[model samples]
Target: MNTAKQRKASLPERGFAWAAAFLLALFLVASLFSLLAVQVMTSAGLHTGTATNDSVLDGQMKIIHNYIGVLADAYGFEAETVRQSVSRDELRDFNLNAAAWWTGVLAEGESRTIPRWYSPAMEQAIRNAVDSAGTGEDPNVILAEITEKIDRTVYPLRESLLTTGLDFVNKRADIPGIVRSLRQVPPLCLVLCILAAGLIALLAAREVFSSLKYYGTALAGAGLVLAAAGIIYAVMQLKAMLSQASANLADEFGTMMHTLFLEAGGAAAVLLLAGFACLFIYRNRFEKHMAPGEEQAA
Candidate 1:
């Protein structure tokens, strides 16, 4: 009876187990929180907000914006111009042509800095047209001049308006939401603290379960999972980029990037915590596994 009583007293109460569990939980939660935050930002269209309407040394952005405006008009956006000035077919042509130009420019490494208000050819064409338009030509005459230049110079390339670009813009809008949530700072800090607590708890649990050798298995499994998540993320990113190039739905690509990079990363961290939890359980079990100093504490 005396020996049993002494051993029972020596064993830790429930508090130790609870603390370890809490730490492990926190670690997993923090990883997930980060993932969710990133996703929210991406979907809200804020990921590349800085890239919009900022100063352009050249008029490249203005041109792109103009194209966007034209596209919006084609979609029945009522502006100063009559809604029918550009037909849907015309818009499609413009979009296709612009995409081709962009692709070609990227291939040639000339896509980096958007040329100011005009490339050499565009500038020359515009100068000629504007000079004629300024001559107080009739409305039809002015339209004719502009149309001629556009047909001769712009229409020949692969300019086609498609819904793909619009879809990309629509999806990008969700990125702002994700960014807003992530930038809150306080919530993220809290999440980090929780994760830290979880890690500690997990370590404690490993100590408790030391006798079973479960910790080793847990760690090995965690390492593999983390590796897998990393690999998956990389593959997803590659796919997203390829889709961005080939498909019309740019927004979808952005979403995929967010999911694979942020969400998957969080999931992997959680897996790591599970491994730690196993370690803590192991540590609390077998005395032989403990270091000399820890053994004394036990």
Candidate 2:
């Protein structure tokens, strides 16, 4: 059995060294985890956006094509009027009118009378090809022909209805652009970086204080300084991370912002608990200030 003096001599002075080393390891793990998680989230968002955009653009093209077909059928114009061989100027005008109709939906509201000239131009062009028919008789025949064509073209109308089912794609587009456009660092990474940096700083402060230790008072003072510096570093980094998160929240995945906040808040709570544990170890192990007489009585 060893005497008190012998036992004391056997113990090394590196008392919180292992604990500090463990925290450093944890900090590194956390940093890597944050980096990987952000990469996964960002990649998923971009991939989803790409697939959704392709589907939406294809669906929109089909709807526009079907709508033009319906317009041609109703007017009973020559097939060439709507065919791809039409003059660029005429096609541009047609597209402008269609775009005007769509844009007007947001302003003048739906059910605006389509300009009379647009229908008559196509009707006159088709009617002029035939001769010797009564004026109203040709238009009546054209109207009946249009109705029959519509009844037969059920597939186009069905395909056009796909747009209504695809409203979700447009909503998804708004967010991915924001995510891609803003190439800032993720808040989680910044927070982890600050955490790792603070942990390293704490380890350094502990080493510095141990080297300067003239007495237990100096060692205790150094531990308190390390803990305080760690807390300050954590707070500053946390604030920067929060600011970045807030900017990202204004994004379309603003819904995801709530989720991110919950995750970050939970991480913060865990760190806070760990900080308190560090302080408890520091106070109990290093800062006991019992008087010499009290120590003798014990």
Candidate 3:
């Protein structure tokens, strides 16, 4: 026991132990960030929240009204006349369905038909317009013309809104696969990190207490980096950065990013605390077991 106590780690062993600790820190940080991303992307609650957000709903309404205004312009009618025909409940349902469809497509790795409520609303608007005008024109003929115009205009808009511009080269189908792979990353990284930590303990120290120093250093380094990055990202003026985007989009994106970063920062704080605790234990408890020379070397 005395002979073992006097033994010191060789320079090569110390180098390898340090390398392992560094890799452990790297893997730990990667695992944390990847886990956060997976949680955000896979969360149904997040998607629902974004879909029902007032800003997002208002933006959708504005876009729909603009399309209605175009139809009114073409047919020589008041835009408000057409807008009045579509109820708020109908618009809400459409937005909800659109959100659901987007979630389904990404999860299932396939394209589904886009949700549509505009054409029916437009038809009702035209019928009201014809009645008010006393134009004596057959409503069916007007409906057919208007329907054709919608197919050319509104249908394309719906498609563009739903499809995320990754329609070519089968990239859209790859989304689900990518998400699956990401889901595996955190667990894999964690396992590798644990292995690296064990390697550091084995290669650098004869006593378990001595290994705590390396563990504390690696954990503290990783925690500091993650906490700083997360806090900085959360505090950035994301909405201002997205000024050119539609108001609703900017607000929703900025809010989402803020929430995500804050959560990350909170998680990193736990890690930072754990790291400090380990260091404290090593200094107060472990140092008593070592000779002055050994303690200084450690």
lDDT of 2 by residue, 206-266 (tens): 3433322222222233344444544664566554554464322123133233344444445
What C-alpha lDDT values do all the predictions have? 0.41, 0.39, 0.68
Point out where model 3 deviates above 4 Å.
Answer: 1-8, 54-93, 118-165, 171-179, 231-238, 286-298
Cα misplacement distance, residue 166 of candidate 1 (Å): 18
Candidate that would win on lDDT:
3
Task: Answer with 2 or 3, whichever has the higher lDDT.
Answer: 3
* Better by TM-score, candidate 3 or 2: 3
Off by over 4 Å in 2: 1-36, 39-251, 285-298
Instruction: Give the per-residue lDDT digits (tens) of candidate 3, residues 7-40.
Output: 6678888788878878888998998888777766
How does each model score on TM-score?
0.32, 0.25, 0.67
Ranking, TM-score, top scorer first: 3, 1, 2
RMSD of 3: 6.1
